[model samples]
Target: MKKTILAAMMFLLVIVPALSEETITVKGSDTMVILAQRWAEKYMQAHKDVVIQVTGGGSGTGISALINGTTDICNASRPMKPSERDKLKARYGSRGVEIKAAMDGLSVYVNESSPVTELSLQQLKGIYTGKITNWSEVGGPNARIILYGRENNSGTYVYFKDNVLEGEDYVSSMQSLPGTAAVVNAVARDKNGIGYGGAAYGKGIRELKMKKDAASPAYPPTLENIRSGDYPVSRFLYLYVRNRPTGTLKEYIDWVLGDDGQKVVTEVGYFPIR
Candidate 1:
């Protein structure tokens, strides 16, 4: 009887803390990971009892986690596909809730030293689709153009393919990286290399001024350009939940959409939804 009481005490000690603490798991978008971490850190500092865990594989990975009930939030650079929505409805009895967390002008990156400063939409599609393989073809030097891109499971990858490539496949020779940071690092080091990712990630690299076509004026991914629809590659960044948030989750989501959280979005180099 004494041993049974001891077992019961041990069980309470182990399970009570687990039940008392609240944890929010955010996973997905490599593009949004830095911003999400910042939000989590700031949120936790104010509410120490609530723990927020953030992870990045890719946007697609995060959506998969949401569908599978493995994560509380999925950060995605692109809107959820129709098939993903269907899966959420099948499991949760509702289409997943989407929160617009930020805006990003999907930027094209090149080494700062490269002279290729701007690209038209057609030129970009041609370069990425392998029809234009040399820098000289686009008015740069004689070097062969090297392409860096995100992997298949990335929402950035899907967005770029659908928007820039117009549903065409990427060039077979393009080097696929795991995340935007990797692509930025590659472009920073490789003078002839070009890559595409969130404008927020353009630190050591150059974010090209993009034109709708050769006939249009070129513009960088500035806030004004994006807001005015002058930036050709701008997109909304998102957080998707299995259902409409409630309890602690709803409170957290509300905070994120509030002023303080939107400020963090700009601080991390992405535009706010507002």
Candidate 2:
């Protein structure tokens, strides 16, 4: 009986370690959810033993998950806040790690039928803040300008608010949607509607060319324009890890930053970090 028990224990020990290779969990940023999932799928094809899971709530949710130790990685479209960094130091004894994975122009979307082909930054701010409530105010048909935006938890929302709104509040009438894709869908069907999100999400909707001011030339959110810093709203997309990544996590991140991973970024309609 003792010999049999020892043999069973030995077998269990050997099998458990082999089966327990960590499954990486990536969470956060609805904007980056599609991109992250694509990367995970392609990476998993090459690495049979590894498992990866991706989820999107928002950048804030992902950062919270990182602080609480619930996710292996957090994808964000914006930089971490100072308060968030402090929380990471308190919980993980580190300031957390940020990896820039891609670039985004943070494009503004308008319905294809809208006559307004371009807007200055101040005009965008005025439109979003309710100061310019009519499409006619910006060279469009005389109609109420319906606004669509992301939820407050979204990094895109914060970035837009900080940079475009200039710290002013969004008009109370603006409808806050759950994701960038949702914003695009809403704008695509509404002639007077306008929205803003990652450039990758502007498929059915038309991307509005933006100028620094009335005197400057309006530029589309093309890769060339973004790379040249002509697109004023361009920002980096990021991946966050609790500490210096190690083991399979490190390997996966390395793969993501490599040539093939960046190719996926371009295929997904976002600019690769390279």
| Candidate 1 structure quality by residue, lDDT tens digits, 135-233 | 999989999999999999888999999999999989999999998999999999999999999887899889999999999999999999998999999
Q: Which residue pairs show backbone clashes in model 1?
A: none
lDDT of 1: 0.94
Q: Which clashing pairs does model 2 show?
A: none
The parts of candidate 1 lying over 4 Å away from their true place are: 1-19
Candidate 2 lDDT over residue span 1-274, tens digit each: 9999999998788877668756999999999999999999999899877899999999999999999999999999999999999999999899999999999999999999888999999999999999999998999998999999999999999999999999999999999999999999999999989999998798988999999998999999889999999988899999999999999999999999999999999999999887
Error of 2 at 168 (Å): 0.7
State in Å the error of residue 10, model 2.
Answer: 17
Among all windows of 10 consecutive residues in model 2, the one with the lowest summed lDDT is 13-22
